[model samples]
Target: MEENIDIEQLRIPEALTGPEAADFLRVVEISRLVRMHTWGNDELAYTAGELLAQCHDPYEWNVMLIARVNGVIEGCAGIAMPLDDNTELAHVTLDVLPQAEGRGMGRKLLEAAEQFVRGENRKSVLVETNHAASALAAAANEAEQIHPTSGTGYLPLSSREARFAFSAGYELERVERFSSCAIPLDEALIAQNMEATHAPHRSKYRVHQWLDACPDRWAGDIARLEQCLDRGQSPGHGDWDIAKLREAEEFSALTGRRTIVTAAECVADDALIGFTSISILNHRQDVAFQDETFVELEHKGKGVGLRIKEANMTKVMREFPEVRTIYTWNAPGNSQLLEVNAQLGFISAGITAQWRKDFNAY
Candidate 1:
């Protein structure tokens, strides 16, 4: 007979030193190790503070469940549902320690996640799987390659993540490329992009910079731009308003992160045409993440994207000279943005596929 596997919901504590800190730390370690084992690196690992802030975020409802066997934690599952919008969707992350695999731990954790979302009355569930570039290329020609509906990227059917998601009744919706660029970027590249951004069409737009908080005059416009970006990806989901924007800013501060933003405004109308943001983790000064880049439909193709990205990059490199690398993700079909990234010296790091299970369809 097997020892009983107990599943319990975690109560996110107010601080890391609280009574539940030990258990929370265990979950964090297990989650970090699982990702490191899978990706062969800790490039995307999260600090405990970062994870805790995510759980405490006011804009989302976050629940974490841990699986224990004989008082030892073996795995965990986290489900996050956006409260402001997309309330019908639950994003789930399941992680099981390598040594604990093949013992039905993953299955149990996933089942718990499904049950929780069902109780919340969510209609859709989303999960992501990561694949290294080398592994993907090795299996590119295999007959079992799974292509997303977008028809632009492929994942190996032989991969464990693909097999697991498929068995769990999830469909491949889209794929994104994770790329990284070393800091102290080449002077020539920066100079060239800057020169190109000075074209007549782009000259009409001026760039604005901020360190942490958005200026009062631009807050409303920033919220609108965020909404536009959200809707551009998921038609009904970009409901960003001023309140949510402030909430996100507060969340960033709570995570001990420095938010740097650069926005482009049309001189003729004084309206924000595009914007880009980069975040630097206070705990890890050598690394940064490119959060988001958005341009109005009419302002694209005129260097708005590149201008804002470069402006933010220049500011970050100057203010934080210790930064070494910046990471970003983009859909394979986003040719324009990909081109801009390539010009900025970003190289492919890995690929991640988005999978979804629609309960309402059943």
Candidate 2:
């Protein structure tokens, strides 16, 4: 039986509760399809369960809109606020089912998302899309730039998606390369050596690994983590405080699929020094994904960074023996961390470019 998509019945909702699981599943399935279509690869496709887990995170304020025709979900859009920083940029991710395309549903969803951001008094909104969506490109180009609010589009690489951003009035701002280095976990002596080198400065600090929940003792460490993250390369955004960092921790605990391995100071210090965490994403039973690793500026130059990483990698190998390959990403300019990983036997896999444009002028 063919269900009719009633554009008029579609509505945007603030939150998804337990009762809406079925509808949310449909939305996620549609979203996965859209992502796969846009990226031309299934490797990036996230399942409905994964989306649900992600949405459960408390740190991100995720909004979902459902386009329904007679109560059947035909399309959906979502937005997330990272770090819960009021001054930081908010991101939007949207998708319409194949049957609902070309019917102006996507435009409606975008408008709803924009209104939500405006209501929050946010400074800007960002979205990532591939080159395949011509209509999305056109919509971005035609989007109005309200005073104090602008839209920018970026292309990571030259593709059908890059052209879309160009047509939408987005310009390339910077190209960030995402590279991964992997090392075999069989070298315990190397790990111990790395730990020993970083031990003098790391003496007062301790490393904690969390598998199922967020640790309470690391609250201060979380705050310091945010500070370090600020120093790292990201799309320009405002700073984060303790409250926001807590929210981020809660969110990761709820949403992240990897083991959260954190190293932090055992005693509080006024200098805001000592801490790092590496999220290991277990994609396949045997593959580990090193999504991010960070250390504070004051703690730099010491072996603290490398020691924490070595400890985390050692833990992952011990706990998840099935994991054969570990993947990681680094900004193009981070030579220090890059050199450390190189010493540990991580080889460059590939590069992903970061592109951006200021939408304020659009």
- Native-referenced Cα lDDT, model 1: 0.87
Least accurate stretch of 10 residues (summed lDDT) in model 1?
Answer: 230-239
lDDT of the candidates, in the order given: 0.87, 0.57
Clashing pairs in 1: none
Residue pairs with backbone overlap in model 2:
5-69, 6-69, 130-161, 131-160, 131-161, 151-359, 176-354, 286-322, 286-323
Best by lDDT: 1
Instruction: Count residue pairs with overlapping backbones in model 1.
Output: 0
lDDT for each residue of candidate 2 in 1-362, tens digit (9 for 90 to 100): 66554433222223545564567667767877776665454444556556655665554666676677567677776877664444555676767776667666666766676677767666566655533334334444443421112222233333544454345444444333333444355476585666567646666666666663446666556655655566665433346666665555565555545554646554446332444344544333555566556666666787767776777777777777666666566654678888777766676644333333344554
Residue-level lDDT of model 1, residues 1-362, one tens digit each, is 56888999988887899667988898889888987887776667777887888898777899999999988998999899988778899999888998888788888888889889999999899998888887787787899878897638878889988998988899998899989989988999999998988877876999999998999899999999888888775344356888878877887777788999999999999999789999998677888999889898888899888988988999999999998999998989889999999999999988989999999877
Q: After superposition, how far is residue 137 of candidate 2 from its true place, in Å?
A: 24
Reference-based lDDT, residue 189, model 1: 95
